[model samples]
Target: MTTALFPPAPVSTWLVPLDDTADGVVASLGLARPEGAPASWLDADERARAARLHDATDRHRWLVSHVALRLLLGAALEVHPSAVSVVREACPRCGGPHGRPALGPSAGRPLRFSLSRSGGHALIALRRGLDVGVDLETATAGTPSPAAPATDGLARWVRTEALLKSTGEGLTRDPDAVALRPTAPGVWSEHVEGDDAAGPELVGPAPTVADLALPSPLVAAVAGPGLDRARVRVHLPATAAA
Candidate 1:
């Protein structure tokens, strides 16, 4: 994509492979922790939440996602990983604390991002000012979880999820109502309101949506205003320590 045809901000996309061994995850992430305690990279609330997850794999995945997020933001801000502050705004619909996550003032600018993980892979997307959402999933042979839409429905499903997540409504909105039509390579036209519903459902403004060119077994998508124009740089071999 040329810069003239579509003016875009610099965006970075990172993929991280989840470690199968839970014990070495902290060290692999280059994070420190007190003896017999959770990783120091996580805040008190995060630690408490992690402690609540009885499943080791689930806990490890959560730790890796948040830790990776902190490291990524810190690298961009040139600060200690733990120093990067993040918060979850209250839901616009119900005034709850489960809304989309946001960076603190320390992040500077309108740094927006979205994080998603499926099976063994984790994805983090970053964009400035423009809101962005990303989803990563694997369609390998296995029982599909309720959280994951079926593999047969990935194209539409992933794009819809990316759009909903971009607006912070998430799965709260009926998935059947969201739809998109491909306009070109890496470009999709979003129908915020579609034939699935009869009312005037507000989905905010549409964003530039596209399917990511990822390796096999993994399907992903990104959505944001002008994102189709944004330069997307994908870094692979997600096993790096940084």
Candidate 2:
């Protein structure tokens, strides 16, 4: 058997491309389609919301995110994927259930995770005892051209989004208000939290932020505790059974 790239304890990140054909072959991941997986796996409101997405790609991305999350959590918790519970907690500022998703009360562990997708890519970051957030963006013609004077702008955007996501506020918080400057090679530390902002932080210590290198035109970053010890593993569709 191929060596399994299991999620490490306490903290780690997984970068996966949503290229797996959704051909009803998630059995190796211990997932059950059972007709209403999306409607049932997602919270009621989210299910209805997902239904309103007119584009098939949008709908498919939603399904992959939720299903992948449950499967990962199930592997970590040693339970069947279908047995895992996910909750979209209320917005910290609005008290509405449209904020970041979290593991439900029955999960029995403080499994914090963040999900982000852009273009054809997706990223999932998880940590056991601290909050975590990840953002992925595929560079396109609209992004600052590599030769543009301010070429680092896209990286800054991902850093800000990752920081906001770590706080569970996500893009709901003004991206302009959060500032991240390069601290070192591959690392960008939070430099400012503008007005209408709280301090930049996660569940515990200041989160370590760093860019992730991928094989595509994607730029990814993650923010969370214990990240200095974190490892990123790429799991392709064929490796699910490993």
TM-score of each: 0.80, 0.77
lDDT of 1 by residue, 72-125 (tens): 666555567677788897786788988999887767757788999987778888
Cα lDDT for residue 180, model 2?
A: 71
Clashes of each: 0, 0
Q: How does candidate 1 score on lDDT?
A: 0.70
Superposing all C-alpha atoms, what RMSD in Å does each candidate have to the true structure? 5.7, 4.6
The count of residue-pair clashes in candidate 2 stands at 0
Cα RMSD, model 2 = 4.6
Looking at model 1, the pairs that clash are none
Candidate with best lDDT: 1
